[model samples]
Target: GEEVAQTPKHLVRGEGQKAKLYCAPIKGHSYVFWYQQVLKNEFKFLISFQNENVFDETGMPKERFSAKCLPNSPCSLEIQATKLEDSAVYFCASSQSGNTEAFFGQGTRLTVV
Candidate 1:
């Protein structure tokens, strides 16, 4: 596809439930990133991959948060145990290269209660 696609526009999870989001990057893109947007104007980088390999994960949570990018499959971000603070929008972005401008998906909104 020419645009990045994200699945399940909205997700509601209990405090201890698991939440998983998927993103299909534009064909031919080599870099993918997952970001969490808590506030309307604030975005926190969660992780990034370069052709199915971890490129950077410095902003990923040490626990409960995990992600993956694999060949022939869409990238994913999973939360093992949802927390109240985990309520936010998860956006997936992809770029042709690390220095190129990224294209973002519509985003998945997760609400934990």
Candidate 2:
């Protein structure tokens, strides 16, 4: 079972502060993706990367959100200058891209003041 795991299932940060989240992908995985779910309803893809390079980041916020996929260190999402609108559940997922389904983490629910 290759499932992603995220920490701090919930997070709270005041405006202008920083928010950091962690994600542990299934062992032996090489591709990781990050997404933001607003209102716990809809999902918005933020970024995707294979290995340590940026694959795509079409839906990411231009002001403050960044992600990385490192070797066995677990992917991470860092958001600077938090805002009320930034409150949402951040999901991390990984897949082998062959016969495996994309596995998602429980997500980190971030709340901003």
Candidate 3:
């Protein structure tokens, strides 16, 4: 079975500052995904990557959010110019395909003021 790992269970930042979250998908996984859970319920897809290439990022928040999948570096999500509404739990996941269930990491909670 595959799993995902993330660190810094919480983050706090002032407005206009930057926030970064980290994730490591289980070994052998080929696809990685980043999601934002603002409501603490439904997961909002942010971006996904296969190998080193981005598969899709249609759900990303324009201008403030960005993600990357670095070679041997796992994955990361960054938020620049944080806002009060940016408080949420960020989750990383890995899956073989969209049809399959994804393995989620222990989420990183971010709070901005």
Candidate 4:
């Protein structure tokens, strides 16, 4: 695919439940990034992968958030014990390399209640 494809445009989760999101990066792109948009203009980088390897995950919450990019599979971000603060629009982006411009998906909006 030429564009990043994200599944389940919207998700509603109860507090303490689990929420998982999927992202299929553009074919041939080697880098995939996951970001959370809490505020309308703020995008916080959570994790990034170079191919199937973890690149950087400094911004990801160590306890409740986990992500993976695997061979021949759509990348995923999973949140365990969902919290109200976890409600946000998650954007998946992909690029040929770290330095290239990224192409983003429409995003998955997660709402925790």
- What lDDT does each candidate get? 0.95, 0.86, 0.87, 0.96
**Which candidate has the top score in TM-score?**
4
Q: Mind giving the per-residue lDDT tens digits that candidate 2 earns over 1-113?
A: 45788998999999999999999988777778888899858989888887778888898886898888777587889999999999999989988762467789999999999
After superposition, candidate 3 runs with Cα above 4 Å error: none
lDDT by residue (tens digit), candidate 1, 1-113: 99999998999999999999999999999999999999675999999999999999999996999999989998999999899999999999999997989999999999999
The residue-by-residue lDDT of candidate 3 on 1-113, one tens digit each, is: 35688978999899999999999888878888898899758789899999778999999987999888889896889999999988999999988765588889989999887
Model 1 accuracy (lDDT, Cα): 0.95
Candidate 4 wrong stretches, greater than 4 Å = none
Please state the error at residue 113 of candidate 4 in Å: 0.5
Off by over 4 Å in 1: none
What are the clashing pairs of model 2?
A: none
| lDDT: the better of candidates 2 and 4 | 4
* Model 3 vs. true fold: TM: 0.92
- Per-candidate clash tally: 0, 0, 0, 0
Find the 10 residues in a row with the least total lDDT in model 2: 94-103
The digit string of per-residue lDDT tens for model 4 on 1-113 reads 99899988999999999999999999999999999999675999999999999999999998999999989999999999999999999999999988989999999999999
